[model samples]
Target: MSARDVLEHLQRLGMSGYEAKAYVALVGAGRPVNGYEVAKRSGVPRSTVYETLGKLVARGAAYELRGSSDATEYLPLPPEALLDRMRREFDGSVAVLRSALPAVAAAPEGHLIHGLKDAEAMLDRAEDVIAGARRGLVMSVWPEEMRRLREAVVDAAERDVEVSVVSFGEDADPFGGGRPGAVYQHKYSAPEAVLEDLGYRLLVVVGDRREAVVGGFGEGAAWGIYTADPAVALMAAEYVRQDIALQILADRVGAGEIDRLFATDPGLLRLLGRARS
Candidate 1:
C-alpha cells in the first residue's frame, strides 16, 4: 500500500497522528530506532513521541527496547498482528455500541417540536420509533430531512421492518432498497396540500401507538407536534393511506406501461414506465 494509504489506515484504526506516523517510520526502518530518530523520520514531535509510543506498546502494535546508546527504541508489530488487534478492538466497540443503543428509550416518546434543534431532536426520536416498529411505517418528508430519514428507513429495512414513505420529489426513496416495503412517489394534488402550511403536518405514524408530526412549512420554518395518542396516530395513518393511495394508483399507470392505455395522468405509473426505459 502507498504511504498515504497506510497512514490513513492507521489513523482510522484509532491511532493519533504522531502514533501513526511513528509506526509507519519504524515499519520502514527495518529495525528498532531510538525516539529522536523515530520522531525525525516520522516528522512527529520529540516531546510527544514517548507518550504515543507507550500507547502503541500497550496496544501490542509497538515495542520498546534497549538501543545502541542504551537509549529507548521502538518497533512496530507485524502488519497482520496490528490488524488483528485493531479488529478485536473494533468488534468489542461494536458489541458495546449495540448493547448500549438498544437500551435507550425515546425521550418524551411523543411531544411537540419547534425550531431547528427541536426538529433535529424529534428526528432522533423518529429513529427509535422506526427501529422498534413491527407492522408498518408512514412518513412525510422533504429534501432537507433526507439525511436522517434515509438512515432510519435503511436501518428499518436492514432489520426487515416495513417502511412506506410519502414525500414531494426531493428525490428521497423513503423506502430505499434496504427495506422491503413501498415508497409512494406521486405528486400531491395541490402545492397547499403538503406537510406544512396546513399546520404541523409532517409526520411518521408507526404501528398504531406512535405518530410524530413536525411542520410549519418547509421554508417558513415553523413548529410542529408529535403525539402518542392513538387518535392522532390514526389520523396520521389515514392521511398517509390517502397519499399512499395516490402513489399506488399513479405508480401503477405512470410508473408502468399502463401509460399507453391511460395517458391523461402522468403520475408514478407513468414515471415508472419512463424509469424502466
Candidate 2:
C-alpha cells in the first residue's frame, strides 16, 4: 500500500532500494526515463542511476535502449512478467536446497540435542549406521529405554538388520514373544538388576558403536550420545556378554540351583569385573 511496503517486498525478491526506486520512477512516469531524469525523479544519485537500472534490467524488471545523442532511456519491464520470473527463480532455489537436506543432515561428529524430535533424528541416524550390519546388532540397554530400542530395532530389522540385545531377564529371550530382535536375558545380576526399573537413563553399546542415553518422560525430553570407536565398544560388548552369563548364574542362585554366587564359582568372579557399569 505504501512505497516502503512495496520496497520491502521487492527487496525480498532481490531488488536493491535504488534499483526498485528507479524502476518505480520509470513505470510511474509512463515514459522512457533517461539516466539523469531517473536520478532526479527517483532521488538516486546521478552517478548511481545507470548501475541501479542495470540491476533492474538483470531481473527483467526494466530495459535500456539507445536514444537520440547516444543517451540511454530506461523502460520498466512488464510487472506481471517480472513477478513471475521472481517466483520461478525463488522456487528453483528452494527445490535445490530441499534436495540437499538429507545429505546435509548426516552426523559428522558427536552432538547433543534436547527433546523428542531431535532424539528421533539421532535414532534415524543410528539406523543409517547399522543398516549394513548383517551378522547382527549386539547392544546392552536398560529396561526403561525399551520403547525406542523396540522402534529402532523394528525399523532396522525391517530393513534387514539382525538385532540382538543383552537385557533385563536371565534365561529369558530378550526380544519377548512377538518382537523381531534378540534379547539375551537375565543379563544384569545382583546389584545391577536393580537398574531395570530405574528409568531409561542407560547406556547402549552395539557393534562398533557405543552411546550413553539418559532421559526421562516418554520422548519429549531425552538426550543421547553416539560414537563408533573400537576400543570403547569392545569394552562395552565384553561387559554385556559377561552380563548375560551373570544373569544366568544369578537366576540359578535365586532358584537354589546353585547355593552360592561366589566362594564356589571362580568363573563368576572372573566375569564380575567385566559386567555392565
Candidate 3:
C-alpha cells in the first residue's frame, strides 16, 4: 500500500490524524527530528505539532530524544515494535473486559419474552445465544438458518457446549457439510406438502435449556420471539426433544411409515389445511 494508506490505517488503530502524520514523517526522516521538522514535512499545523508529538511519545508510538543543542527530537517507534505493543495492550483490555463485565452485570430475570423482527435480528440473537451457551443447545432449523449460524454453533461446540440440531431441509448435514454434533435430518415423505403447508421455515433454539428463540422465515418476511422464561424455555426444549424422538422412531419403524401417519392424521391434516389469513 501507499504511504498515505499506511498512515490512514495507523490512524484507524487509535492514532490521531496529526499523530499519524507526524509519526509517518519521523519514520520517513529515518532519524531523530525536532517538532519543527516533523510539522514542516508532515504538513501538520505548528500549533499542535508539539502536543501531538508528546502524545505519540506517551503512547509508545515515538521516543523523545535530547539533541546536541538540547532540543527535544522525536523518533518514530519501529513499525514492528509499535504493532507488538498495540497487540499486547488490546489483548489485555479484552481479557479484563471478559472477566469484569460478566461479574458486574445484573443477572437475567426469567419470564421475559422479547419480540424480534426480521431475519437479521433473529440471526443476531441466535449468535448471542449460542455464544453465551455454557452447558448445551437444542435447535430445530433449516439449511438456510443452519448456514447463517454455523460459526457460532461451531464455536460453542469447540468450547464443549453440547449441541443437538434437528435440521429440516434437503441437505442432511448442515455443519459445513460435516457432523459436529448430534444431527437428525427430518425425512417427511411428502416434503413438498409439508413445505407448502407451512409456507415458511421454522427455527427454534434453546441455550442451556434456559433461554429460547423461536421464529420463522419466508413469504417475504421474518419474525421471532426470544424468551428467558423458564416455562417457555422448557417448552421449547421439549419441542426439539419431540422432534428428536420422532427421528429416532422413524429410524426404527421406517421414515415412510411415520410420514404416512402424518399424512393421514386428521388433526394434522386440518391444521395444515387451514387457510392463511
Candidate 4:
C-alpha cells in the first residue's frame, strides 16, 4: 500500500493524523529522529510534532530516547509488533463484549422482519439460513444464485439436513451436476418468461421451518424480507413444495400438457397474472 494508505489505516486504528504521520516518518527514517526531523519528513506541523510523538510514546507505539546531547528522539515500534499488539487488544475487547453485551439488554420478544436491500445481503442471509438448518431447507432459486449458494446447501445436506431445491433457468444441472439434495428443475416456464411475468427474479428460502427469506433479484437492484415468523416460513416452504410437486406432475404427465393448461385455464392464467384471451 501507499504511504498515504498506511497513514490512513493507522488513523483508523486510533492514531491521530499527526501521530500516524510522525510514526511513519520515524519508521521511514530507519533511526531515532528528533521532533524537527519528524515534522520535516512527515509534513506534521512543528508545533504539534512533539505532542504527537509524546502520544505515540504513551501508547507504546513509539519509544522516546534521550541522547548524549540531552535531545529527545522518537523511534517507532516496528510495524509488525504494533499490528500484533493491536490485534491482541482488539480480540480481547471483542471477547469481553461478547460476554458482557447480553447483560445490557434482553432480546426483543417478537419475531422480527429484516429488509435486505441488495443482492449480496440477500445471498448472505440465504447462505446463513442454509448453513444454520438443522432439520430441513426448502428453496426456489435461479441458476446464478444456486451456484453461489451451492456449497452452503451441500454442506447442510452433508450434515444430514434434508435439502430441497426448485431451480429455474436453462441449466440442466443446477447443482453443477452434483446431487446435493432433491433438486427439481422448474419446467413450467422459462426463466425469462417468469422474470417478465413477475417483473423480477424471485428467490425464496426457508430453513428448519423456523425462518424464511423471500426476495426479488433484478438488474442492478435487489430487495428482500427475512423473517423468523413461523407463518411466513411455512408459506415460503409451501411455495417451494408446491413448485416441486408441480414439476413432478409435469414429469409424470408432460410439459406440453401443463403449458396447454396454463395457456387456457382461467385459474392458472389468473395465478400467472395474465388476462384471459
Candidate 5:
C-alpha cells in the first residue's frame, strides 16, 4: 500500500495522525530519530513532534532512547510486532464487550424481526442462522447464494445440525458435489419463471425451527427479514419442507407431469401469478 494508506490504517488502529506520521518517519529512518528529524521527515509540527513521540512510546508503538548527548530519540516498534500487539488488544477488548454488553441491557423477549437492507447483509444473516443451528436447518436457496453460503452450511452439517436444502437454479449444490445432508434440486418451477413471477430470486433459511431469514435478490437490489419469531421460523421451515416434498414427488411421478399440471391448472397458475390459456 501507499505510505498515505499505511498512515490512514495506523490512525484507524488508534494512533493519532501525528503519532502515525512520527512512527512512520522513525521506521523509515531505519534508526532512532530525534524530534527535529521526525518533524522534518513526517511533516508533523516541530512543536507537537515530541508530544506525538511520547504518545507513541506510551502506546508501545515506539521506544524512547536517551543518547550520550542527552538528546531523546524515538525508534518505531517493528511493524510486525506492532500489528501482533494491536490484534491481541483488539481481540481482548471484543471478548470483554461480548460478555459485558449483554448484561447492560437484556434483549426484550418477543418475536424480534430485523430488516436487512441489501444482499450482503441478507447473506450474512443467513450465515449466522446456519452457524447457530444446533438441531436442524432448512433452506431454500438459489445457485448464487448457495455458493456463498455453502461453507457455513457444510460446517453446520458437520456439527450434526441435520441440514436440509432445496436448491433452485441449474447449478445448485448444497456441498459442491458431495452431499453432507439432504439436498433436493427444486424442479416444480423454473428459476426464470419464478423470478418473472416474483420479480426476484428468493431465499429462505430456518435454523433449529427457532430463527429464520427470508429474502429476495435482484440485479442490483436486495431486501430481507431476519426473525426469531417461532411462527415466522416455522413458516420458513415449512416452505423448504414443501419444496423438498414436491421435488420428491416429481422424482416419483415425473417432472414433466408436474409441470403439465401446474401449466394447465387455473388455481396453480393463479398462485404463480399467471393466467391459463
Candidate 6:
C-alpha cells in the first residue's frame, strides 16, 4: 500500500495525522532520525515534528535517543509492539466503559433510520438481529441472502423464538437452505420480474417487532435502511405478515388468479417478459 493509505489506516486506528505520518516515516527510515529528518521525510512541518514525536514517545509508539552534539533522535517502536500496546489500551478502556455505562439509564431511543450501502453489512446486521431475537422474527428474503443467514434463523428457532420466513422462488425452499421453520414460498409472482423492474431484490427482516431492516440488493449497489422506530418496524413486519397472508390466500384460491394478476399488470408484464429472456 501507498504511504498515504498506511497513514489513513493508522489515523482510523486513533493516531493523529502528524503522528501517523511521523511513525510511517520512522518505520521506513530503518535507522533513527532527528526531528528535522522526520519532518522532511514525513512531509510534516519542521516546527511541529518535535511536538508530534514527543506525543508518539508518550504513547509508547516511538523511542527517544540521545546522540552526539546534544542532538535528539527518534526511533519508531516496532510495529508489532506499538500495535500490541494500543490493543491492550483499547481493551482496558472498553472493559471499563462496558461496566460503567449500563448503570446510567439509557435515553429513549428515537425514531432513527440508518442507511447501509454494502450487501455484506446489510446481511451481517440481519444476522445479528436474528441471533438476538427472543420472541419472533419475520423476514422476506431471496435464496441468495437466505443462504448466508440460515444458521442464525435456525438457531433462533431452536431457542423457541417464533420464526416466519418468506422465500421468493418457485419451490417451497426454506429460507437460507437449512432446516425449515415457518416458511412460505411465493411462487405466483416472479421475484426475477420484480428484480427486472426494480433492478434489485427487496429483503425485509423484522426482529421481535422491535426493529427492521429493509433493503434492495443489486449486483454491487445494495442499499438498506435499518430502523428501530416502533411504528416503522411494525409496518415492515406487517409487510411480511401480509405477504404470508397472500401466500395463504393463494394456497386456498389457487395460484391461477394470482399468476394472472402479475402476468397482466402492465409494469409486471414488461419486467416479466424481460425476466423470461
Identify the candidate with maximal TM-score.
Answer: 5
| TM-score head-to-head 1 vs 6, winner | 6
Candidate 4 residue spans exceeding 4 A from truth: 1-107, 170-174, 260-265, 275-277
Better of 4 and 5 by lDDT: 5
For candidate 5, list the clashing residue pairs, or say none: none
Tell me the tens digit of each residue's lDDT in model 1 across 142-236. 65565666777777667766677776564656554333347665474333454443444355545534555544434535355555666767777
Error of 2 at 191 (Å): 8.5
Each prediction's TM-score versus the true structure: 0.53, 0.40, 0.65, 0.62, 0.70, 0.60
Question: What does candidate 4's lDDT look like per residue over 1-277, in tens digits?
Answer: 9998998999899898998889889999999989999999999999988888889999999999999899998889999999999999889998999889988967879987999999999999999899879999998988778778888887887898888888886453345657744787787666677888889879999999899889998887999999999888998899889888988989888999888988889888899777655
Per-residue lDDT tens digits of candidate 2, residues 96-154? Answer: 98888866897757434233235565555455445535545666655554555566565
lDDT of 3 by residue, 16-105 (tens): 888899989999999899999999999999999999999999998999999889999998899899999989998998899999999998
Taken over the whole model, the C-alpha lDDT of each candidate is 0.68, 0.63, 0.84, 0.87, 0.89, 0.84
Best by lDDT: 5
* Colliding residue pairs in candidate 3: 111-229
RMSD of each: 9.3, 13.4, 5.6, 5.6, 4.3, 7.4
- Off-target runs (Cα >4 Å) in candidate 2 are 1-132, 169-175, 179-181, 187-193, 196-200, 208-224, 248-261, 265-277
